[model samples]
Target: MADKSNAESIITETQKRISNAFDVFDHESNKTVDVREIGTIIRSLGCFPSEAELHDIIAELEDEEPTGFVRYEKFLPTMTKILLERKFRPITEDLLLQAFEVLDQQKKGHLEPEELTKYLTQEGEPFTQEEIDEMLSAAVDPDKNVILYKDFVSMMTFDDTR
Candidate 1:
């Protein structure tokens, strides 16, 4: 129940922020924001993507409209992705810690290999056994057969090459 309420509040707040951004950037009142406006929006959100990166982002939106603009509805997903990836790193790390705490039932600050597998497959957002095995192989300490809280958080927050 509490989790549900928190999720709802997050969604509501995200919608409010997006709406506010749309209002600020949609200069022509055409319900779409131009590429120039997008650059301003991205900067306002505190992400300073390089000129090439910004050009690439704008290029991706070219197909969305003939005028090379993105409608507010269409822009929300991109905005959300950027905010999550850049502005919310600390929040992401904190969420990972909370999840680790749930699995560390005895407050031992680490999980036995088997406990890690069980938690991954049975609890929230179940992953396949193969996925769990791969994750363990990548980050688990072989001699101890346990994954420390720090290692687990590091693994979760790792930036994939892709």
Candidate 2:
């Protein structure tokens, strides 16, 4: 079903991100990143966890040496799961509708292309123009030249990786 493919896509995306993050943060290329590197990685993602919170996160990971280092191969899945659940879990229909309402300032019941672009490129983790274009290409209704709330929600939730 669509849900199964979506889950697979999510897993695949998470794994790719995790691998890239590990490569970026593992400065020494030791196949592991230290606790400090871990904190830096988290901060790079626009999240700032307290020292205690960071410690708790590392504690949850099973480390062979307990040296405050995360081995990419050993901990990638856990890291991906944590990132997906904490930051990228699927949005609920009600939440999506409410967000659409907020964005649809004129209560037009749909978003014009410009409005959608603005929303996508808003401050804090802004999307690139290419990304916005790709999203619009997928979500926009060809006949309407706009994105209805339902279509937007479905596009946002749909994952094609079966």
Candidate 3:
């Protein structure tokens, strides 16, 4: 019974977040948004579904009416499932550390700023110069001029913004 209630709570909370994300695109104050904005809304809620996944979602939602509008009410259940069951979340701290390890050829458990910047700006999902600088600024050990990747991973994966 407790598990069931907890699941319900999760569903409710997920729905609330989806609604809030949808609200951002509901400029007319109506509870509907353009079908095209579905992907944007889902991304805003922190779930980066792949292109194929997004296409499937849009196709399913468009099955009812070709109105090109998504009703938050109709979307709530799907959004909740996506939030609760989706696999593509921010990488785990350990995983992030492993990625950093690849750049740390010495296996020293840290990275020099220049090396990290080069990898971050030239590798898969490359960051812009500005992004690399911002992240390095926060994670760099000023005294050592290196990034303690373990600590950086911790901050990236678990920092409390509030």
Best by TM-score: 3
Query: How do the candidates rank by lDDT, highest first?
Result: 3, 2, 1
Model 2, stretches more than 4 Å misplaced? 1-72, 80-88, 158-162
Instruction: Count backbone clashes in candidate 3.
Output: 0
What's the CA RMSD of model 2 in angstroms?
10.3
TM-score computed on alpha carbons, candidate 3: 0.60
lDDT of 1 at 136: 86
Indicate which candidate wins on lDDT: 3
- After TM-score superposition, the amount by which residue 142's alpha carbon in candidate 2 deviates from its true location, in angstroms, is 0.4
RMSD of each: 13.6, 10.3, 5.2
Clash totals in order:
0, 0, 0
What residue pairs are clashing in model 3? none
User: Native-vs-model 3 lDDT?
Assistant: 0.79
**Which stretch of 10 consecutive residues in model 1 shows the poorest summed lDDT?**
84-93
True lDDT of residue 160, candidate 1:
27
